[model samples]
Target: MNRELPVFIRSLPLVLAGWVFAPLIPAHATELPLLFSDGAVLQRDQPLPVWGWAKPGSQITVTFDGGTAKTHASSSGEWRVELPVHAAGGPYELSVAERGGETLRVRDVLVGDVWLASGQSNMEFPVAKAQNARAEIARAGDAGIRHFKVPRSWSDKPEPRLAGGYWRAASPGNAGDFSAVGYFFARELRTRDSRVPIGIVDSTWGGSAIEAWMSAGMLGADATVAAEKIRAKGAAAAQAATQTRARIAAWNTAPPSPEAWAAAALEESGWAGISVPAQWETQGYAGMDGVAWYRKSFELSAPETKGELTLGLGQIDDSDRVWVNGQPVGGMDASWNVPRVYRVPAAALRVGRNTIAVQVTDLGAGGGMAGSAEQLYLRAAGGPLRSLAGEWKFRTADVRLSSTQDDINQVDTALYNAMIRPLQPYALRGTIWYQGEANAYPGAAFRYRDLFASMIRGWRADWSAPQLPFLWVQLAGFHSGGDTAGESPWAVLRESQSAALALPATAQALAIDIGESNDIHPRNKQEVGRRLALAARAVAYGESLVHSGPVFRAATFDDTKARITFDLQHSALAVRGGGRAVHGFELSGADGHFHPAQALIDGGAVVVSSEAVVQPQALRYAWNDDPKQADLINRDGLPASPFRAERTRATLPQQTKQETR
Candidate 1:
C-alpha cells in the first residue's frame, strides 16, 4: 500500500518502546498525534479522546462539532481532553488549540462505527489478489468507507502513539490495497445499513503468531521473566533492523539486474544447490530474508515444445517474478500462497534445452517455493507432466534478518506494544480476528483454548467495554497430513478457536468449506467476510437471525448406534449438495479407535452407526485436517462447525429388558 514513512517520522530517534519525543513540541506550538490528523475516523457514540503535546502547564482546548473540552498539559508536556459523546454522523472539523498559542485544525473528520480488524496473513490479504478483484476494485469508490492501516512495528513496552499512518477513503486505486476481508466486511455492513459510516482499522502482519499480539500481562505467570527476555531481544532486533534497513536501502539504489540474472546464458557454477518446492528456511538458509534467485534447466522433446507449455512453480512465500528462456512470463507481488501458473507460449519454448529462472522475495517469515513436489511441473498438450522437483541452482541476491529472526515482531507482546497499545481506549464497536496457523502445532494448539479467550477478555478490559463484541474466523481446511480419526493440529486449533465462543458476546465464522487444500491463504475471502458480517449482525447489532449453523448439543448411545443432537437455532438441519446420507461422521467404542460411520438425517438429529463397532462410546464430525466430504449445513446454507462429542454414560444401560425384547 506504499506505506513508506515520511523522512521526519523515519528519522525520529529510537527510544525505549520506540517512543516519539513528547518534549520536542515548541513552547507556543500545540501538536496532536497523527491519528488526529485529517481524514481520521473517530468512533461515534462514545466519549472521544483528543490528545496532544503542549508546553508544560499549558492550557489546551479541544473542540469538535458543538462539543468543547479543556485540560492542562502535565509536567511531561502531554495533554488530553475528552469531547462529549457523538452519534454516527460527521464531515466535521476538529480543532486542538493552546489557550493562547497556535491552533491545529483537522478537516473532514468522520464519526462512525470503527472496527478494529487485527490478525495475520489472511486478514492482511489485499483486495487486489482476491477473486473477482477487477470488478470489486472498480466498484470500490465508497466515500463512506475509510481505512486506517497501522504501520508494521514492534516494541517491548507500550508506545503512546503510532509511528505514522493516515486514513484513506475507499477508491478504485486505494481499495485494491485495503484488506480484502475488512473491505468486504464493511461492504456487507453497508448493504444492511448505510446510515453510519464504517471505518476499518487494519493492524495486521503476515505470519505473525497469536502470542505476538498479546500483552505480557495478559499471558499470566512467569511472564515477567519472559517479558524481560523479550525486551532484551527487542533491543537487539531494533539494532539489527536498523542495519538491515540501511543495507536494503543501499541495495535498492542499484540492485542487480533481473535481466542478467534470468539470461539463458548466465553463468551459475557458483550458485548453491538447493531442493525445489521447499522453503529456503528448511535449507541451509534458515533465518534469512530478502531476494534470492533460483535457476534450473529442463530438456523438452520436439512434440512437447509445439504447444503452449504450462509452468507450475508451486507457491512462493512472499512474492515472485518468473522468466522462461530470458522472457518474462508472469509475476505477482502479493498472494504469496497462490500457485504461480504461467502460460509459456510456444514461441518461448525450445525443442531441447530451456532455462527457467524465478526470483523470489520473502518479506518476512518462511520463504521460497512450497507445496507438494507434484505441484511443481511442466505440461503441454496431452503429454505427461515433466517434473521440476530435482535440485536447482540458488543464489542469495540480498538479505534482511529482521523479519526472520526471533527478536522481531514474532515475540510475545511485540505487536501489542507498538501496534495495538497505542490505539487502545479508542472506542470501537468490536474486533474481528483471523489467525492461529502459527500456533497450530501439535503441542501448541491446545494452549490456544485459554490463551485466545484471555486475549479477548484482555482486549475488552483495555477498552473498558466489558461486553464488546468479538468475532474470529475458525481455522480452515488445509492438508497438513494426519489420519482422519487421529489427532489433527488444524482440527485441534479449530476446536480451541470454538472454545472462545463461551465468552460473552462472541461469535465464530466458519471457513472449513471454503479453504483450498494446497493454499494456506484462500482467495475466497468474500465468503469469509460474508460469514463474519453475519456474525457481526448477530453479536454486535442485536440481530435475532441464525448467524451460525447448527451447533453440536449432545450425543446419546444405544448399544450399536449414536444419535447426535444439535442446538439448531431458528434453522432446520439438512445435508448440503442434495445428498440424503450425511458425511464426516466417525464412531468409536471403549478401545478408543475410530472407524468410518454411516450417518442419516433424523429430523433434529443425525444417527450414526458403523458395523465395525459393536458399541459406540464417542462420535466426531468433520474430524480431519481436510474434511473434504463434510456437508452438514443449516437450511441457511452455512456449514456446521467441526465438533466431537462423547456419549453420556447415564443415557445408556446394560442391555435393558425392553431392549432385549
Candidate 2:
C-alpha cells in the first residue's frame, strides 16, 4: 500500500480488512466543527486545541501562526491537535489536514481573550433593542471585536457538536443581532486594550431558568429526577409540538368566518373567567403553547362613545390580533415586551356594552395579555382613564396536547445538553451571566443559593479552570412599588446571586436601580455593561480600582439608635442624589416588624433611627421587588447590593435603667 495513495485507495485496505474496520472509516468527508470556521477567535496565551472529524486512525496535522501539531483520529473518527501558545494578535489562518483525506482551512482567525456570555432573556436581548441602539450600531465597525451566537437547541444527552453557528465581526449589519450586554462588554474590553482582539460567545434563551443551563451532575437528586421524567416524554413532546404547529397553521390560514367570537353579541356562557394584565401561564393555562382568545366587556356613556378612544392592551406575548366590537383595531408580533395600544374609531364604539376581544398566539412559553394593571386602560377624549384590569371571558382557541414545547427549555440540563455541553474545554478568559428572573419563584429563589454556586463550580470543572472568574448581574428592581417590600421573591433571588460571591474569583454587578417597573427586560444595558467591565477589570485583570459599591460590614445597636458600618476601600459611602440623608433603610424591634428608618451619615458609618421602633433589632436596605428610591452608592457611582442584617443582641452595649426608660 502506497503512503501517498488517494482516500478511496487507502480505504480499500480497510474494506478488505473486514466489516468491523469499515465502520471506523467515516462515511462523510473530513470536516471541522462550526466553532473552528472562518472568522473564529481562539483564546490566546493558552495551548490552542484544534479539532475536527476524519477517518479513524488517520494521521491529522494542524498548522497555525508558524506552528504545527500532529495527532491521530480516534475510533469514533474524532481528532484533536494542540498547537503552541500564541500571543494576542492574528488575522491569520488555521488549517487542519488529514493524510489521504480532505484539508480544511479557516481564514481570518484571531488569538485573543474569548469570553462566554450566557443566561436568560436579558443576556439574549439584542443590541438593536438596547438604549441608543441606532447610534451604537452605526459606530460598530471594530474588526477586533467578534461574536459567536449559539443557536437554540435541546437534547436528551450531551451533543458532540453545535446545531449551527458562525463567527461574525462587529459591524453595523451584524452587530444589531449581537447580544447587547455581550457587545458592550467586548467593546469596552477592546477599548482598554486596542491591540488585543476580543471575542464573545453568546449562549442564551429567553424565559429560561438557571436550572435549565446546568447538568444533571450539578443538580440536586430531586431536580435530576424531575428532568428525567420530562426526558422520558421526549418523543411524545415532539409529536405534540408537530401536531400543535400544524393545527395552529390550519387555524391561521383558514380562521373562523367574520370572527364571530369577537362580536359583542356573542354568548359568553361557555367561556371561562380569566384575569387580564397577566400571563396565561400563571392563570389556569400553564404549559400551553398556541393560540388563545380573551374578551372583555365594558360600558361607556353616549358622549364617551361619540369621541375617539384609545384602547391600551398593555403587552401581548409573541403576537396578537385585537378587535373592538368585532372591528379589527390593531395587531403586532415578535415584540412581547412592548406595550400594545390600539386606536378605536368613534364608529367602532357604542353607547354601552362594547366588547374588546384579542386573539393571542404564543409560539412557546408564556402567552396572552401580560402587563401591569396600570397599563390596561381606556382613555376617551377629555375624560379620565377607565380601568380594564378586571376578569375577562377567556377560551382556548388552540393548544399543544403536550406541554413539552413550552417547558423544554426549562427542564433541568436540557439546554446544557445542547447549548453548553459541546463547548466544553474551549479556552475562555471568563464568563458573564445575567439571569435569575425566571428563578425568582418562591421556592426556587431560596434554593438558587446552592444551585447557582454548584453550577459555577461545575462549569469551572468542565473547563478545568479551578479559578475561573465568574461575574453576574444581580436581579434588578421590578414590580410596582408599594408595601410589597417585606418579603420579595426578586429580592431573595438577588440575595442568592450575591451569596455565590463566597466562591473565589466571583463578582456581582448590582442592577437594582436600572430595572423598569413595568418591563422585565430593561434597555439600560449600557450601564450594565460598564459595571460588568469594571468587575472584569478588578477580578480578571487584577486592577486595583474599586469595582463595587459599599458592602455591609457590621452594625451596632445603642439605646435609641442603630449604627451601621460598611466595607468601603478606596472609596467612601455617599448618598446617590447628593442628599445628606440615606433612604431605603428599615428597622425592626422585638416584634420583628420593620418600619421605615431615617438614616444620617455620621462620618464613615450611618446612624439609623426610627420613632416607630423603640429598640431596633434588625435592619434591611433596598429590600423590595422594586426599590425605586433606594439611593445608596459609593464614590465610584455604583449602587450597593440589597442586604438584610440582624442586630447582635448579646453584643449590644448595656444601657442604664434610665436610658431604657
Candidate 3:
C-alpha cells in the first residue's frame, strides 16, 4: 500500500544477490577465531557447533570430512553452523568459506570428550609450581591430552563468546602452563581410556568471589543477591571515597622532616614491641586497627656495589608501603594473602648502617607481617647481600581509610566476563570445582550452595548438555576443632557442597583427612587429584570402582544408643586412628545442645551413645570449624564425609526443598 514498498521490495533481489556474491571479497571476511582450542573434544552424538564472526550478512559455508553446511551472518556479524554428529574419531580437517572468496582451514580436529575445569586460585594454580612438577613435565608428551586456557575478563552482561585463547596439545614444554588440576584430571582420564581425545579448558581466576562469576541477570533475579550486591557496592564506594579523601589530605599535609624522621629512626621511639611474622591480634594488639609502622636497622658493607637489590619483607596484611633509607622502594595494596618480593634498584642502598622501614595497614581480621621465618635478604647486583629480617625496630601509626566506587566496579564481573563467557559452546565431559574457602565465613556461605548449583546449571544450560557430570571437592578439615558442639560455617558449607550432589550426574570427593590443620592450602594435591579422578571414573567413565568413602545414609536411635548406618563403597567402616572407638560423634537431645558421644564401628555402621544425651534426638559427625579428631575412615582408606543427622522425619530432599522454598 505504501508508495516506496514496491521499490524497496524490488531492491530485495539485489540485496540477496549481494549477500550471495559477497563470498568473493576476501579471505577471513567471515571467519571468527575459535576459542577453547586446546584439547577440545566434540561430543560424539551431538550436533557440534562451529561458530565465529564475519562481515555482516556474509554467506558462510563450512566443510569437514565429506559433509558440508552453510549459514548466513546476521546483522550482528556473528554466524554459527552445526556440524553433523560424528563418532569418537578425529585427526580431521575443517574449512570455512565466506564472502570475498576467503577460506579458513583448521587441522587436527578430533571427536571425543571435552571438559571445563574452573574454580579459584587453587584451580588456577599452574603445574609449574605443583609438587613433582619436573616429573610431571617429563611425562607431558600426550597428544591425546589438549588444553585451552580462557583469558581473564568480566562483564555485567552475559556474553556469547570470550575474548582470547586457543587450543594446544600437551607437551613437556607447554604442560607447565596448564592448570595443575585440569592437567592431572585429564591425565587420569586419558590413562583410563586412550581411544578418546581429551580436551580441558581452564577458566579459573585467582582470588575471585563466587558472585563475580555469576551472570548479572542471575544476581539481579534473587533478592538476596540484589541486597548483597547493593550493600557491597555501598561499602566499596564508601571505602573508595574515604581512601581518596585521606590520600588527598595526606598529600596536602606537611611532609615529614627528613632530619626528624632520621632522628626518630635512630631513637627506639614509642613504637610498641611486637614480634615479627606474628599477627597483631595475637601480639596483644587486639581490636587495635589502622596502619602500624615497623623499623629495623642493618649495617651495610662499606662499598655498596651498584647492582640488583632483593628485598624480602615476608608478607604484610592487607597492604603495605615499604621504605629503605627514607626512599620508597616498593608497595603492595590488597595483596596481603601472598608474600611480597621487591627487587630494589642498587641506588636505594647505602654504604653504612641503613634504616629499613615498613608501614602495614590492616583492613580486617589478622593483620601485620606473616609468612615463613626465612631471612629477609638484600642482595647486591650479581652479588650476595645481608639478611635484614632478624631484629628490627618497630613503630605503629593510626590511619583510617576505605575504597572507592571505581575499585568496586573494576572488580565486578571482571573474572566471569574474561574467564568464563569465552569458553562457552565448547563440548565438555564434566566439571571439577575446588572452592568455598573464600566463602567459609558465617552467614556468607548459606546461599553459596545454591549459587554453586545455579552456576553448574547455568553452564549446563549454556552448553546444552543437561546430563554433564559435575564433581567437586568437599571442604577439608582445617583450623583447630574446639570441644564445644556448635554450628560451624565450614561444616555447613561442606554440607552444602555435599547437598549439591543432589543435582543430576553429580559427585563429590571427600578430603577430610588429606587437609592440613595448620594450612588452608593443603600441600597434598596429588591425593585431591586422585580422589577427583575416582569420582570421574564413576560419574564420567561409567566405572564400577569404589569412588567415595562413606556417605551418611540414615540414623536411628533406641533409648540412649543411636545406630548410624552409612553407604560405604568398596570397604567396611574403620577408624583411622587405630582406636576401637570411632571419633567425631556427637549426640544431642531435644535441648539441641550436642555433647561428644562414645562411638564404635560395628560392621558398616557406627553406634553412638552418651550419658549426657540419654534421649538422643540428633547426631553429628565431624561437625566443627576445624575437625581434628575426625577419624571416621572406611576400609578403602578414604575418610567419611562430614554430616549432621536428626531422628525426625526430615529427609535430604525435604531439607533441600525447604531451604529453596
Candidate structures ordered by lDDT, highest first: 1, 2, 3
- Tens-digit per-residue lDDT, 442-519, candidate 1: 667777788899999999999899999999999788876643345676777888888888899999999999998866
Residue-wise C-alpha lDDT for candidate 3, range 78-170, written one tens digit per residue: 888888988788888778888576787777878777778877656766776568889988889998888887654444344556655688888
Please identify which of the two predictions, 1 or 3, would achieve the higher lDDT against the true structure: 1
Clashing pairs in 2: none
Candidate 1 Cα outliers beyond 4 Å, as residue runs? 1-29, 221-224, 235-260, 269-291, 296-356, 361-364, 369-392, 395-407, 482-485, 649-661
Candidate 2 stretches with Cα past 4 Å from truth are: 1-28, 222-227, 252-315, 318-348, 351-364, 370-404, 480-485, 649-661
The lowest-lDDT stretch of 10 consecutive residues in candidate 3 is 11-20
Tell me the deviation in Å of residue 545 in model 3.
2.1
Number of colliding residue pairs in each model? 0, 0, 33
What lDDT tens digits, residue by residue, belong to model 2 across residues 380-459? 86689999998988776655432234456677888887788878767899999998887786667777888999999999
Residue-level error in angstroms, candidate 1, position 108: 1.0
